[model samples]
Target: MAPEYALNGLFSVKSDVFSFGILVLEVISGLKSKGFYHPNHSQNLIGHAWKLWNEGRPLELIDICLASSCMLSEALRCIHVSLLCVQHHPEDRPNMASVVIMLGSEIALTHPKQPGFFTKMESHEAGNQSSSTNEMSITLLEPR
Candidate 1:
């Protein structure tokens, strides 16, 4: 689920883009975002992908099985496009038409900003505990 939808009960075209981005990441990595686990960090699949991307190791996110058959450049482009779709702000995300163009062409992609719900989980935290990160707090001001 997109962070805005999950937290604010808001939904939009960008929300579907976020979901698509996650699906792309999951497809490439052969891992589910909800239950993603990494021995070295508490990041879920999206965070882990972002970490690898920042470290110039995006290829490391690809599944080993596909590594043998997938075109490296295409995989990298997909990752780039997926990241763009999942930007933290809905305004920052491209529309579906742009996403299709990005996937089908060699156009240059912009660097992805921090993703929504980018919060890190505790290393000891279990997957069953709140699948989505809840970092934002709302304090409703009610005057009596």
Candidate 2:
């Protein structure tokens, strides 16, 4: 999950797109961003994925599970779409409607910006903030 608070009460269909992006990366890489820990700069799976992507070697991030079953173009397309959905700027991320279209079409895609929560620390900080907010809002008051 991309920290509930990160959705900032804007949790519409776009929020699902963000989640789908993360899932796609995990599915492709066989690595969960949450569980990832690196000694250098303490980056997570998202950072590593971005790094590989920037290096023009995104194929290095693909999961072994896809070795024989996946088509190269399709796998790369999924990665591209996933990256697009996870761009740090919400406005840069595509809506589900556009995502569906992008996936179905063979047209060239725009370059992806960096994914959200680029570092493990950022992810941890956001998660902590969200947890505290959730704790404070435990009361059940009637809506006006």
Best by TM-score: 1
lDDT of 2 by residue, 33-115 (tens): 66575445456778778888998999988988885788889889889999998877677789989989998999899999888
lDDT of 1 by residue, 73-108 (tens): 999999898888888889999999999999999988
Report lDDT (Cα) of residue 49, candidate 1.
Answer: 91
Query: What is candidate 2's CA lDDT for residue 23?
Result: 87
Instruction: Output the lDDT of residue 92, model 1.
Output: 96
Return the number of clashes found in candidate 2: 0
TM-score per model over all chains: 0.85, 0.73
